[model samples]
Target: MSTQTSLALWAPRLLSVLRIVAALIFMAHGTQKLLGFPPGSGGGPAAMSLPWIAGVIEIVTGVLLTIGLFTRPAAFIASGTMAAAYWMAHAPRDFFPVNNGGDAAILYCFVFLYLVAAGPGPWSVDAKRR
Candidate 1:
């Protein structure tokens, strides 16, 4: 096959891989916030607060995104969560992500936004169901 054809064929698979990896990483953040696993975030069965709420959203959306179920909506929600996180937690600390430690939040926001526009690709449950 031509190089262009090869890239075209592989693109969807690459998107699926990206979705899986990003969801797993995002889920880890939730685990840290809610379960205290991986030993960070000072988490422990969190109370009903901003962090707790964000953690819940993260976990739920992460799972949905990981399995490619309701991917567009999940990604859209995740993107919104990240936007809120950046504004609420990081923006107040500093103007730029690098200064405020909000790089991950910003990155996740854009990536999830991309996923929202792109859908879950061929390997997703969304694709299978269709």
Candidate 2:
């Protein structure tokens, strides 16, 4: 294949990697909340009460993203979780996403949105299944 074609083919693969990485990150946060596995105090089910629901979404959606199963729904749920995180956890501060800002949530929302629109591409299990 030509250089352009090769780059084009690999582009989706790179995006898949990004999706997996982002999902894994979200999964870790969810795991921390769900199971106080690690030594330190995790985000426990009591940390933020209402918004804690996002923890469930994060865990399920992260798994979906990892396997490229139900990509759209997973990304949608992930986006919602991030949005909730922004409003409930970070919006009280500035928008810079620093110490207590909504930056991380904003970024997470965008990442999930991208995956939703892109549909997991060639490197996903969804693609393989099809």
lDDT, candidate 1, 1-130, per-residue tens? 9999999999999999999999999988888888887787444654898888888988999999999999999999999999999999999998988999999999999999999999998888999999
Poorest lDDT segment (10 consecutive residues) of candidate 2: 34-43
Q: How much does candidate 2 score in TM-score?
A: 0.84
> Candidate 2: where are CA atoms >4 Å away?
1-4
Clashes of 1: 0
Task: Return model 1's CA RMSD, one decimal.
Answer: 1.2
lDDT of model 1, residue 94: 89
Query: How many clashing pairs per prediction, in order?
Result: 0, 1
lDDT of 2: 0.82
What lDDT would each prediction earn against the true structure?
0.92, 0.82
Residue clash pairs of candidate 2 = 97-103
Q: Write the per-residue lDDT of candidate 2 for residues 21-96, one digit (tens) a residue.
A: 8998887777777775444473477756664677777888989998788888899888988987888778777656
